[model samples]
Target chain A: MTKTHYFYIGYGLLCLLGITSPLLNPWEGATTVWDRLYLKFYGVSPYGGFSLLSFLFYSIIYTGFLYQFQLFLTDYLSGRFYYTAIRYQSLARWFIHLGWQMSYKAACFLVVLATVTVLIGLALGDSPELTVSVLSNLTVIQLLIQFLLNGWLQLMNGLMIVFITAWVFKEPSYNLIAMGLLTIAALPVLNAGGWLPAGLNSTAYLSGQWEDLILITMKLVVYLLIQLVVIAVLFKRKNIAFY
Target chain B: MKLIEVVNVSKSFKGIQIFNQANAVFEQGNIYGILGPNGSGKSVLFKLICGFIKPDQGDIIIHPSYRSRRADFPQNFGIIIDRPGYAAGLTGFENLKRWAEIRNQIKDEDIKRTMRVVGLDPDARQKMKSYSLGMKQKIAFAQAIMENQQVLILDEPFNAMDVDSVKVLRELLIKYKQEGRTIILTSHNEEDIELLCDQVYQIRSHKLVPVNTMAKV
Candidate 1:
């Protein structure tokens, strides 16, 4: 197996032991799988002043995913990339292929996180039915689907932001801008709306109304499409010099 | 026939000129050598030839064959402008096999023969991370010639290679030239340039100056 496969296994173990273990323990207060998920996402909020430990735990996953992605992206910056890229008919096609790979990685990470959450929740005897205060209109299955879709979108947004930032600055090291953005977005503040870049990932910001959810989802999708165009433009002029 | 031409090409980085109205010609069935001091943009010229980077001014006219293939970069050209990289966890053979799978022009026996040509054990299971620098360079060389590319742009292709391996590669390059392949390389070793190059050029004052005609240009 590749190092990436091992990394996923390690990430799963870390989540099981560090994040979900304490949150889903039977000794914790009245909680269903929905409640556990709610608390988990609640810690992602900038305003609530929720569990600091929980927030840090989830942040590790986010940070780790970004770190892995950064490494993957930089691999193409090496000299060998030119040799491989020339084999392709067009550099744009190669860039698009890389985008698809990045999207696949984002989806895979969400699946890993979801699998770990479900395993922990089931083992601890938490009911799968929805019990969260927010998004009360949706059934358990719908809520879960929304959660996965939202999580995947947020990860894609983050990845694109990092990629665009690096390309704009013409420095691979500029990926730290994403880390800084995450730090500022995580700062405690009142009324942290879903409009905040990082807060969009928080379930606490999700409204009960399906209209709001759809609007937010559409907005994110549009924003991601625009970002894709911007990245392609930047890449068109980017010089692949890595001395 | 002229295979590649750099016509009045000018390039600069961060406002510092690397090349200014430079001109050079590479024809088929010849080994050309470029010599330059550190920071002289030897690699940049190779990158320009391979279409990895654009020249700021003037044109790099590749032969019609590349354009005929509809490839933005030069097709069927083997390049090693910088240190080659591969999956560090995979064996040398496996790494070459993975790269070969991209074009599917070469099979397992071809890969093994290339490895043997470069003085590597094709059956060895040693991962790339464990290979010495010389071994790694051989792997890079093996990959470059494995597909029988007609054009080769190599920068410091013999770096880190031992004497015997270097001699073997030098002979292989001559053999490639005999087979009507065009090869361009940069080397610090005077012997490599003396024994191999059909024509030699040196990077001087942001231009490629023909070594034998240095008094004129």
Candidate 2:
């Protein structure tokens, strides 16, 4: 990957971090509702102590970093494939890469519309009153943009595996298995419900910046681990041409 | 109008002149042969007609009936220049399937029919890596004949073929000619040139001349 591309990804993370600082003090009305929900749900020991916007922002930026890491790493894997194939055509392979990005963004748009509709319905009480203002929901937009940006990057990495199998891979059957792994790794985390835990900021047993760094790093590490295994499994099959 | 016209087309390489000033008219249904020595610009001339390369100072015009525009060189001609290259990782059938999808020519059953015509194993989904040189040549031939093109240009189409395979290609070319399809084939072998060409052109000193009156036998 280019140095300029790496800078862009880092800049995106820094921008998200700046936007998330203001969620430290949410609206009083939003705070009261959260307090009541915490009391009813978890016997009032601050079960839902934080704002929803904070969690959403944290997950969005965290996943964004991992997404850039995946792109850089997969490019290495793809470069290996390109040199090994007897007559690999990058011209044809480009289309497969582009198609994945287009489809990913189209899904992200539908998800954004659905999130806004759900938030609006909950804020209103079947009257024509506009209770929730736009600025408070500003963090929601940040959550979605990061999802889409990272989602496309992950999809590109996934399709790179398919391209390698049909074009550069010496063995044929492993293509199917590698593609299965890619599909699972890139599945959207948005629709997994509360059971899977919120992506970046689930209430852990610890708190503060150190806890945040440890948790975020761990998530990034797991994401990279999955990608490494996928590449290694494909690379070590037999006489890996080392191209 | 002539089906295809080449007016004063010339090309040079470094300081050497290959085709200085050449003109030819090709009519429909003629089996024109390009005959010359090993480095006599036979392949270069074919590339010029296929629009793969450009002449230094002239225009090539295929008749409107032959093709609508110049960018559609691929549509007008079924050609082989230099050598036939295929994606070795893909099976011949898979390679042909992608080609069909690109060209919108020869769907499923048409592919089967073309395979039969060229005597290749349509069911041979084996990666082209396992194919012999002759088998790869046959695959290119099968692709070239897919859409029943009106004009065919082939450069040394039988370079790596065995006796039986050569005979099959000759018969295939003859069948296309019998249907009044304009064809051009270039080769150095006297026998192939004699058997396939109606009129032979010699590239001498960057000029193309019909070989009716050579100075020697």
Candidate 3:
């Protein structure tokens, strides 16, 4: 099998483990691995702790990063797909060529993941009342909007990191690490300096008060513009043959 | 009429000069071969014509009908520079299909025919990662010729091919030229230069100079 097959298989197994672990052990597993990682690294978890909503939010963000990383690895191994796509001058095709479909599939996977976690969380009676209140307080419409907006923001962030790394290093692993370090370093400064709005300051945007919605939306727009500008500059200045 | 004109172009990378005040013209419906030692800027010259890279100090003018003054790539051209890259996860046919979608001028049958012409089996299921070097070269050739572009720029197009494949490609080049397509190629192989090209030039001292075809042959 090709390396791509292996990558998909590995990703499938990870999603399976993340989903099933909750059913097997209710108290710990339903909180998506990303939330756990965020808790470990940043000393903060989305929504103040683990909940069904936080799990879904973190899973979506994690999926974005994983999808971007897969694209990076694919480009590194093939050395032709991204370059050829750029030469054709179609941004949509370029995204499709680099596995943008996977990100959409990841969204579907998160839905399934959230449902399974909710079912298992209720069945196991692990803070069932808390899950109930969380589900009720956030209506389906609000939840859907949050999912779509937050997922887009995460995907944009992921793409920006990949584009910046491709511009500078053109290597996948190093780029991933560099992006990680840069984010970790930048977030604290952005947060402390009050450059970002309160709702945009942390992954806690999922539970942000309704009044902060406008601020969050504006932040998303600004991030999207930055992503487009970065991609345009990268394509315009960088030589295809060099990569 | 001139199909491409590179007027007083100069290029350098990281302070290393590749070409200095290089000027060359390619006429319509002729096969032009560039002969130079490795790193003599043969590929760079072809890239400039294709608009893959900008020259440090000159303008490359393609026929007005084909491209605008500031376009980065010519509108009707096929090119293979350095090693051809395709998606490793995609089958040979799929890679070509994706590229054909970008051009939107060729159908599936065209891609199949081009693959067959290049001696590649379009039905082959193996991804590009599993392809041998010769197979990769053939796939690259297939992509370049599939769209039936008016101009072709091929750098070292015959690399890693067997004798028979090379012969087939030479015939294909002749066929392309016969159809009034302007073809630009670079080669270190004197036999290739002699057998295929209508006019030959060698890069000497960072400039293109016409060589005696009779003397090279």
Candidate 4:
């Protein structure tokens, strides 16, 4: 297989693992109740939505994203009107690519985690969680490892995405590069503070970290935006049509 | 219909002019070979026709629609410029899968069948990085034929092929022409020029001047 093919396969496997991890943690009767319900003690449910149905639902959505990603890659590589083969590549952009798939899922993950945090908070008590969830109260602490590792995965992914886009489209603007850095940097900060919840943040933790996290998030988002605008300007100058 | 036409074409590199007012014509269903001395811009002419490189002064037009550029087209066309581009790190199967649907010319099953025709492994379980130069050439050929395009551009088909491989390709090109496909191939092998092409375009004096018959050993 080609490196890109392996990259697709390997990345799919990693993303599959990332997606399935939640399912394992939250599946009922699969783990001890101690493992199942504890956000502090266990972590983010072994899955999502409190059931296999939930996991299945998210899996379907993820598969759609994955499918679109594959299509985008196909079209990006060989499809050209000049060449005339496939449709436009949606996952063509770095921000849209990273932020679109995992980041969006990460966003939904935060919302789900938030919603679960509140419901569980009402059902269980404050500080009720799992051990894996509790490995670090600070996601930034995990950023060096877990979150950082996630960021690192995304960084490599983003880098690869940008590299390929530039290679195929033959246009890699400074904005794209700058935006990529900003996304990686800012995304981790949000993850650190709490935009897209991972690790284990109970309701109590979410509330307290809200303000500082928001600030960090704004800084990152604005930097990301500026980079995007710069990219937009570059695209405009070069007459790049994203269509 | 005029299959290919170049008008008022000019080329330059780093303030050096190599081609000026170069023009040529290619008719449909003809197997044309390009021949030239080194630095005669033979490959450059092929690229300009294949839409890889643009001439600074003039434009090339492919007839029936009179558009020469691939970027301006609405339908399918295929090309292999200079050297083939492939992801050497992927499996042959996986790599083909990446390009199997080029221009929507071939379906997935057709691609698989083509891969099989070229003796590529069904599963393409081997990475292209590990492929020998011979294997890589075969894969490149498979990719080109995978999509049944009307116009096929091959810069140098005999780059690393064995004699048998070359023979196979000659037969394959003849078969494709029988099916009425336009193939524009360039090679240093005079035999390739003689055996395959119906006509030959020689890059002499920085221009494509048609040789009456491209058949001579």
Measured against the true two-chain complex, the DockQ scores of the candidates, in the order shown, are 0.55, 0.02, 0.41, 0.05
Candidate 3 residue lDDT tens string, A1-243: 756568767766665555445332233332333332222112223334435433443343464355546464546534464336434544344655554654565466546545555565445454433222332243334444544555455455555556566655655666657555534433333454323322242334445356454456666678767766776776676354444
Best by TM-score: 1
| Model 1, position A136: C-alpha lDDT score | 51
Clashing pairs in 3: none
Q: What is the TM-score of chain A alone in each candidate?
A: 0.80, 0.30, 0.60, 0.34
Model 1 residue runs over 4 Å out of place are: A1-14, A21-30, A43-51, A130-135, A168-172, A186-193, A196-199, B68-70, B213-217
- Best to worst by lDDT, what's the order? 1, 3, 2, 4
Worst 10 residues of 4 chain A by lDDT: A82-91
Candidate 1: lDDT of B38?
Answer: 87
Which portions of model 2 show Cα errors greater than 4 Å?
A1-243, B69-74, B213-217
Which candidate wins on DockQ?
A: 1
Report how far residue A231 has shifted in candidate 2, in Å: 34
Residue-wise C-alpha lDDT for candidate 4, range B1-217, written one tens digit per residue:
6887889899875577768898877788888887777777766675567554567889778664534232323123556544545665567766667655433445778877887776667675777767888787777677667767677777787678788878877888899899888888888888888888888878777777878652334
> What is candidate 4's lDDT per residue for A1-243, written digit by digit as tens?
445566667645544443334544443322222222232212222222233333333333333333444444443443222222211111123235334555555445334433443454444433333332422343423222222233223333333344345443553353355333433332323345444322222211222244543443344444445545655554333212221
**lDDT at residue B190 of model 4 (Cα atoms):** 82
Q: Please give the CA lDDT of all the candidate structures.
A: 0.75, 0.53, 0.65, 0.52
For candidate 1, write residues B88-143 as lDDT tens digits. 77899998897787788999999999999999999998998789998988888888
True-contact fraction for model 4? 0.00
Fnat: each model in turn: 0.53, 0.00, 0.27, 0.00
Model 3, C-alpha of A221: deviation from truth (Å): 1.7
CA-only RMSD, every prediction: 3.3, 16.4, 5.1, 11.0
**TM value for model 1:** 0.89
Q: Taking the tens digit of each residue's C-alpha lDDT, what string does model 1 give over A124-181?
A: 7877665653435545554555467876777788888877765556566778767666
lDDT of 3 by residue, B1-217 (tens): 8999988899887688988888888999999999888988887787677765678898788898777454456667777777778777789999999888876888999999999999999998998888999998888888888888778888889999999999999998998899899999987788998888888888888888878776866
> For chain B alone, what TM-score does every candidate structure achieve against the true structure?
0.96, 0.92, 0.96, 0.88
